[model samples]
Target: MESETVTKRKTSNETNKKTDSLDDEEEIGLKAKMTLINGVTVIVGAYCYAELGTMIKKSGADYAYIMETFGPFLAFIRLWIECMIVRPCSQAIVALTFSVYVLKPFFPDCQPPDDAARILAFCCICTLTFVNCWDVKWATAVQDIFTYAKLLALFVIIAAGLYFLLNELQDPVKNLPRAIAISCTLVTVVYFFTNVAFYTILSPEEVLGSEAVAVTFADRCFGLFAWTIPVFVALSTFGAVNGILLTSSRLFYAGACEGQMPEILTMIQIHRLTPTPAVLIMALLSMLYLMSSNIFALINYVGFATWLSIGAAVLCLPWLRWKQPDLQRPIKVNLLFPIFYLLATLFVVIVPMIASPVETGYGCLMILSSIPVYAVCVAWKNKPKWFNKSLSVMTTILQKLLMVLGKSNKPAQV
Candidate 1:
């Protein structure tokens, strides 16, 4: 009887061990699957935005609308700021934070104080900026390639999502104009203001903002399939930043090399083929701004500038249409498209002014802030000669002093 009992016990133990092994294998498999899904989703999302841009361009609304309302100078300024400063900074902060946040729940003990988190966020920003500035070649090779892939992937994801939302779900409200407007508006505000605060405040040693959407998504969807979404989002945005940095660096380099900026900005490290000085300068300025009080206000100020610029761009459409009517248009807007674009631009322009007192007091502040910068750049360039040269010189001196004392660099310079 005792021998029989021993044999049964051994058999039971073996079975339990096998079951445990199987469970482990299943867990690993699920994780792998989730990672893949997450990556794909991010790629698709990015792709959707790319497609949207293409659509906007093709519709011919961007140029025609902007030229008509804001004039070329303002339109150009708007494009320059959005492309060089606002979008890049915002995207970088969001991407990096979101990526880190996605891993947070997995390592619960890693959570730090808000201040500490913000500091770490600043470090991340500095690190990435340093990498981009350290060597143009290295930055170009690693960052740009990854960014292209990311953009392609995101475009795919977004297109797929739109399709799914519109077709697969077959929701009646998918095509509703009001719904589209609301959704776009929300996304625009989130995208615009979040980065300003992120660059201006959260880059320091303190954590101010909430964990990113990607991380939030990860926590909400603990399971494999669900967790994948956030992972993909992180990947997509990370790559997007890579691309933004590449373009931005080149723009700065070109400007500086052409004598449009301070001579120090043109310095390039021979070994890394990077703009070490430029990167360091930019990182310092961004950090100082971030560490200062009322970072949110600065962010709003930046947002106001960005929106005004975009509005100007929208207004340019009519001028471009008239001046370059014979120019080849890759994308053509319908008769109604310009009207729609103008209306949207008007709404964007007016809403902020109306909401400024209650929300940010940002409407005129941003315009005032840009005046000096624009004046200086114009004087330095001296091509069109729109603004006063003396004012430009004064503003430039003040800006330089602020940068020197505060260790801050403009995104445009970066």
Candidate 2:
């Protein structure tokens, strides 16, 4: 679970942007070296998460760990930023990428139509949401199939580079770290070599200028087979959308489980035994986000808050070690892992302010906006009788409509 979850975190949609980012700074010559350095930094953070995931053993990922370590107040803030902005925006962006690739072949001479792409993206979200709400086994089955298909596409790219060079676990306590370590290492190598393949097939200027690096590489190297690239990319992004929905719904369910989110979100389908309400809410949010014209800008606007929340969660490692010396920890990372990861995270959140002040400012405001929301929805004890009655009635209606029961009911697993 951790391996697939972490691999999906390094979604393929961002691969081209990484090349563009390196070249945007006129550092094309050093892209390979910098990629290695960045990979090392990410591996350190992955280890930190592996340790935390092992200790907490919760579904919300960062949100779950934050709640355990930081208490409800701070946890709610992280939850707000994540559920309101990050997850939905990410799902929209990746789904849109999937649509664009799927439609690219038809519009060879031009960009895909926005309306068509968005409609396709909407359909993709709805399909994945239905699968997720139906059953966990079904979702994982989809994940497993697409994960392999995308990996084959990735290896095809890697093979073209050298024409050559070649390519989870039970007992999470002992095996989870190994799974995470191996997953991160493989991802880093694949990414690095894929970039090398791009550079090998296309010149530096070409790489910097091309809108879709993989497509361009395929055109250059796979002349008769150029069309396969778009198909491969579409499959990759579509699978990524499925993976994101699978994980993000769990985050919402975890929040509701702890009473941080609406009670409806904690309910699972009595028949399918899946988190139906939470999955539907995630799909609805992602669709709303797809309507935004500047989806990438929305991502930038939440970048600071995303890293900040993750850093806060990682910081909990050391704090917990000190605060609860006797807390059972099946896995404990070296203090240096969290120390380095926090430092990298600090650099991430702070540097963006100097580089993109407006977006960073908006990110800060978005996070701070949660305070008033927290005060009203979570913190304040007193509430009007009518408001409580309305909420209760709404929850009851939605539960029956969705054929779900609250966690308290403990519906039998299918």
Best by lDDT: 2
User: Model 1: how large is the Cα RMSD against the reference?
Assistant: 14.8
Best by TM-score: 2
Model 1: per-residue Cα lDDT over 198-241, one tens digit each: 22222222223344433432343234554454456655555555
For model 2 the local lDDT of residue 353 reads 90
In candidate 1, how many Å is residue 371 off? 2.2
Clashes of each: 56, 0
**Candidate 2: misplaced stretches above 4 Å?**
1-29, 164-173, 410-414
Model 1 TM-score is 0.52
Q: Against the hidden true structure, what lDDT does model 2 obtain?
A: 0.81
